[model samples]
Target: MNSLKHHILSGLFMWVLSMQAQQRPNILWINADDLGLELGCYGNLDLKTPNIDRLAKQGVLYKRAYATAPICSASRSSMITGMYPTSVNSQDHRTINMTPLPDGIEPITTYFRRAGYFCSNGNSHNMSRGGKGDFNFLAENIFDGTDWRQRKEGQPFFAQVQIHEPHRDFVKDKEHPISADKVTLPACYPNHPLLRADWAMYLESVQACDKQVGIILDRLEKDGLAENTIVFFFGDNGRPHLRDKQFLYEGGLQVPLIVRYPDHFKSKVIEKELVSLIDVSATSLELVEIKLPNYLQGNIFLGKKASKREFVYGFRDRAGDAVENMRSICNGRYKLIWNRTPDRPWMQLSSYKKAQYPAFSLYNVLYKKGELAAPFNQFMVATKPEIELFDLKKDPLEFNNLADSKKYQKIKEQLFQEISTQMVAFEKNRIPEGEKTIEKAKASSLKYYVEKIKTHNPLFTADTTDEELLKDWENRLLKK
Candidate 1:
């Protein structure tokens, strides 16, 4: 009888062990900035990105994935909070780093830690660059390039790493052609060599980021954590160029979202389902059995058949704030952009409108002289038709603004209602004014970006000696 009992208990134990092993899978989230669907898996052969491509092959690729906001601060804020920018009231456009991660919101890291997982991250972007909020990475601004293996041991761990190599700084190369000759132009932008070269440089930055991603994945396999981890790769927002980063167009708000889970999720799949970065926090929480909070607006994208968000919304606010700056609202298929300050230079607002692009400068001179007036000049002049709408199918580049057209009234009406509803919600739940109201709030928000925007007086002049305000500005920016 004792021998028989022992046999039964041993068999039962084995069965329970199998069940537990099948249930818990480690999670690793790798977020890159401005990287679009130009991967080998996404079908761009100009660059060689094997590791990330491997993850896409093994997991699922969400082709129509999007960021909640076009700019860095707002988009990242949406990701950390699991709520739309307006819902959080942090959608002031670019002041994300102006405040600490909002209070009462549980960051993904904190949630994972509560659920018995260790977390760490690596990112090189200026912490002030984004609204670096309350997601609990162990240390800020300190993740070395590719040393993810040195994190704590004994328990299953989750690591979220960020790579910014593909941002703006480095984008010049050859053979891996990202230049003008092979450039695809959005009708909003003029197709010229300078624009093409500019686009190529940005693409190169993305490819360089891929090389780093490959190295990190190799570390995972080499360290024996390959089978136990889940890998998710995505961009922070759209590309960093003019219309891409600050606008509500497809190129600016839509990002490539890919996920690779070990054996639990293995297959080449494309999910037409729309998922927002905001949902990432909730999804991570659900994976670890932590209760997803009620305050969060994001739902888990668990490949489960019952996810509830029909359309994703995006936000844009206070880009430069001089004039022509505005806010936007996007539902996966259609987007509405509102220009509150319309007198600003439209084309000059773009980061790519450099003097290096002789044609651009020539056009700018003509525009100022009242000679050139197309959509480009109209855009630079902060021209507004109240609501700008686009159908993603016909114009993936989002160049043609269809708000004033006779046919798209239904589209405009539908989006207007959605944007109004979400904005009301955002104002209610966001943080307090915190010892400041209007003017002070603006200063607080503009602490980091103000120097560049406010340059006409004592600085921004060519005669001034070299200044160290960059460092001082960075430090002040971080404190707020």
Candidate 2:
């Protein structure tokens, strides 16, 4: 009888465990566009992000999280697929249309969907354009719908909510406006009123983003899903500033990451693991007990089989209206940037970047007036070294390039060899060419997009079109 009782108890325990697995928690991914680790929780006292701060306090905050690429579509594409943008031929800042993913590779959402999880690109309200998770690949088959509301009853969900706040055209908050005088400026930028105002406006947008985060959390609680939901928050790329956006600097590549894994993880813990945004897919898969596919290059940094990465890689390709190539590798303390197009100037003309970009325009004015200083003028440098290295510990701003230093030559060669090996492993082109071909493609793509817009709205002619309008059209076209 005792033996029978033992068997029954064991069966009951197995049944309980099976039920827990069946009730697999929902995954909520919140990504902020063009944002860095500038929140209150990240020790930035300038911005008021109490809601995000609270979330960080209740979760695991990563201090050294980096994005695979620094531009929007490239970074997001790399992020969603767990593949480098260059490897998938999506390294460009924006594509003419929704470029399909490379052969035999599918979005990470496909795996979630296959595992009986309803995959969505927004919240659970069926709101369109709910979040701007702009990846270069098409999303028609990836997202079952805009939100998890379309899912069958009793099914779990994996949802991504993108916050477009703190991007360009920073909307001000009159109720609690962040004063320009109180805002702290990056030493690289000038202490001009316009620059300060730009910084203040960005802080206000951050506040707005925090409020949105609070709303999402409240909605989860209202729906009685908070206890069983794993919420992940991170930035899609870096800050929206000129040097911080498309460049491979610390300000461009590093982003904030917070994860609240329901009851599984300890609260208020700071995780200092060297993590890449591409790792998000692998981490989520492990958390959900799904086997990761072989094609994914990202390492899992959570759950029972977590592993730490020694170095994080970054890539930069063609930006809007310009063709360029740059690659970077960072091993937490030191960083190396390889500029394939060293002859090109930093301030290449991009209709999208120049329009509605306050910092870029202001910097251009400063450059013309010969008022730009030190690191601020670095953005306008006509020629850069083919390879640049920095000891991030000593030069936080990355102003001094130690690539040419005799003492650091050994370190520079090591990083160069390491990065080069990685590039070969990923099948990345060490030397990019055909600048004229790329520019032609951009012009053809833009012309085709303008024609399409004109078809719908007859008033959107070449003469009548404004730079802002063109920028929006380009964005829409790139997303297809």
Candidate 3:
């Protein structure tokens, strides 16, 4: 009779554990590559993103969401680990040698899996090959499978769906093509016909990405998981454009963020608080009733007890062959950028920029001809200011420079001190990769770009100056 009682008690305990697992909300992260605040929900009426707009209406929309890093690998590394990329020596884009994460620190998936959550990562369109995990740290056993459907019966899940759209090689939406005439170009960029057409193509790609989001949401509802799933849709970084993807400017750092959880988070709420992409990690763990690890730098920005950040920081390290070290701090109203390597030109010799960005050639040609405008021309200079201060409230496009202005000296100094303090803290726990590794990476990147340029642009010659080559490309683009 004692043995029978033991068996019955064990069965009841197992049943209780199963019920707890089922009660936990399934987390779904839809990460869009190189997308920005151009969605219909973000007040860009020129773009048609019906699905994303509907998602915003169903939940909360963040207006001032920013990524920790402008580049993918660094940004994603922070997002996954809930730690600053600088702290983990993951600041550089595509590090030569990936390092294992710190002893106590692990990917968020590890925590989810420990709590009986089935973790899956896969491309939104294809589930066979898995999704983009461009993390600088070595990640093994991060996910149990490529799709959540493979999980056991009644098991909760943490799934990431990578949507690679609107990055580059912009895929035109044949079904609904956007007109160049209707698009509004940024004042920083030259208002040329070719640029307008390019912008339209980018919008088309964004529209296509919206369709993909709709498909995923529809599937969730069709499978009866939408009601219980917590959905997060956001970009990995800023939009893929000249001076946008690799820089610390708002064009690169700012991204669209939308969250939906039925009966948990309030619907139709527009959150204007400064939120970092890394916060998603902490928020997800909190919503699932998991204790946030002490080492996590991300703040919980969702529940009733959500905290708002006073300042959002961004970092930019070496991107491909071009080496740079820049840091930015924004306190909603003002922003400060500290450039470590001020000697390097803003338009450095980056092969990816030369080939992928048509505007690169156009800018070079226009600058050489003395046709580029004031603030735009500033970027073409051989050297940049070591410090740049901008009043974001007065200058949304970041055209004015107030670093040297005596009136703003107090504000600038305060920001400088805050950033300095933060950097010192980050440096305390940083893992250095040594100078030799960085040099090797620089050499490899340079070699790759040289070979690519020669193979593709036959007109490009060793003797051809930048101005000459750019002029030729510009003429061809205009003609088209």
| Best model number under TM-score | 3
Off by over 4 Å in 1: 1-23, 93-103, 124-150, 173-179, 185-188, 269-271, 305-308, 320-331, 340-363, 369-373, 430-480
Per-residue lDDT tens digits for candidate 3, residues 1-480, read: 999999999999877876787899999999999998989989998889999999999989999999999889999999999988887778889988777887788899988987879999988888766999899888688889888888999999999999999787788899998888889887767788868877888899999999999988998999899999999999999998887899999999999999999987787655558999989999999999877889998999988659988999998888887788899999999999999899999898776777667778778878878988877888888998999999988998887989999999999999999999999976565565568877888777766656655764776644445666556545644454
Per-model TM values vs. the true structure:
0.75, 0.85, 0.93
Deviation in angstroms for 80 in model 3? Answer: 0.4
**In candidate 1, what are the lDDT values of residues 38-69, reduced to their tens digit?**
66777776666777787788887887778877
- Sort the candidates on TM-score, descending order: 3, 2, 1
- Which whole-number lDDT from 0 to 100 does residue 39 have in model 2? 92
Displacement of the residue 175 alpha carbon in candidate 3, Å:
0.7
* lDDT (0 to 1) per candidate: 0.61, 0.78, 0.86
> Model 3 segments beyond 4 Å from truth?
1-16, 269-271, 432-435, 447-480
Across 342-429, the per-residue lDDT of candidate 2 in tens digits comes to: 9988787655555445566566666777978877787787788999899888998888899888999888888899998888867552
